[model samples]
Target: MSSLRETVPWQEEPDDGTDGPVVPSRDGAAEDIRLFDGAMDPAREEGLLAGLELLGADAARGAQLDFELLRGWQQHVLHTPQPSAFRNLPAFAKKGRERYGIAPDTRARLDACLAESSTAGGRSLPLAARAARACLDVCFFHPFEDGNARSAFLTLLFVLAREGVALNDVGLLRRITFQATDPQDALILARYFDAHLAETRRGAACPGS
Candidate 1:
């Protein structure tokens, strides 16, 4: 059974020497470009669940899991991204390892993001918006190896869940991965996550208020 990290396709085109950053294929289109086979393996799923549990525990303990921790965790999760038939999680991870720069300031940025989601506990719109935005920003910052986006998604989910936001079912996240638009799939994904968080808040508030 292939791992989710192994099964998910990845985009690997070189930057077109453009002034601006190169965006990945948005949404589902990304899937077409990078194809993978295998149903969600139970063992792999269990492992992911276990990892989430650890992250939850760390949050519960009020441990300051900074970018360095995230980087290490991500390194363990994915293979480096490479130009091959199958996406190379390690290569992607290596890219993150290089781009994220081993500086104290980088850690500070990650800390700020974690603090915002964990401590401030702002309003629904702003909180969810920031969570989604942070995911994109972190990815844009290229803070870790191959699974930066995946880590960001997980991180955002943790923040929202901790903040009393009832997130969409896991199915929704799976759907987003399969339906993202081309050339900006990550952005589309961030928007979907934000909207879903807002929707969850509305559903929760309607009965009480």
Candidate 2:
């Protein structure tokens, strides 16, 4: 069966623009920076950062990603820290544009996607492209009951870190959202990753470091 797909209003695609803190330090990378410039919900933002750190540590240690790891990330994002469990019922997602149907084999499917995303240490495609596709996979899968978007964001970071591409600036990555069926979404995201990588390399320092 076809999975859920979401449609969003597209303008000529306007300009894109652009982490951290309250999380335990591990690798001594930058601790905290704003993902967005304006005000944000402090508690939610803190959870996101903590979750990212947890994901980042896994990436740093060369750990393979699976559904259990994803659940761990979700728990951290919610600051709830629960055992692994997929969504038990149909769930509306993507601003309520679509309903994710309950599937009997969702756990196995999500695990397959994670396994497929980790292919060959991402040698088959350019590093950023792998990351973009991984982001889309997590976005479309909608594996958890809550924080799927945050989970997808963490996946992007994990893929990037696996390939040794760290972004001090996340302007393109965080400024927009993606659905599973967004045509050309992967290509557009790859270009954004490329731009972010180029900008980060040119600056020669982490944006907030």
Against the true structure, candidate 2 reaches a TM-score of 0.76
Name model 1 segments beyond 4 Å from true: 1-43, 71-125, 170-191, 198-209
Candidate 2 local lDDT, 160-197, one digit each (tens): 77656576567677777665566567678877876766
Each candidate: what lDDT? 0.43, 0.64
Mind giving the per-residue lDDT tens digits that candidate 1 earns over 24-139? 22222223212311134443444344445555665556555456545544543453242112122323233233333344355455566545444444432244344554455455
Error of 2 at 149 (Å): 0.8
Kindly report which residue stretches of model 2 are placed more than 4 angstroms away from their true locations once superposed: 1-38, 119-123, 205-209
RMSD of 2: 7.1
TM-score of each: 0.49, 0.76
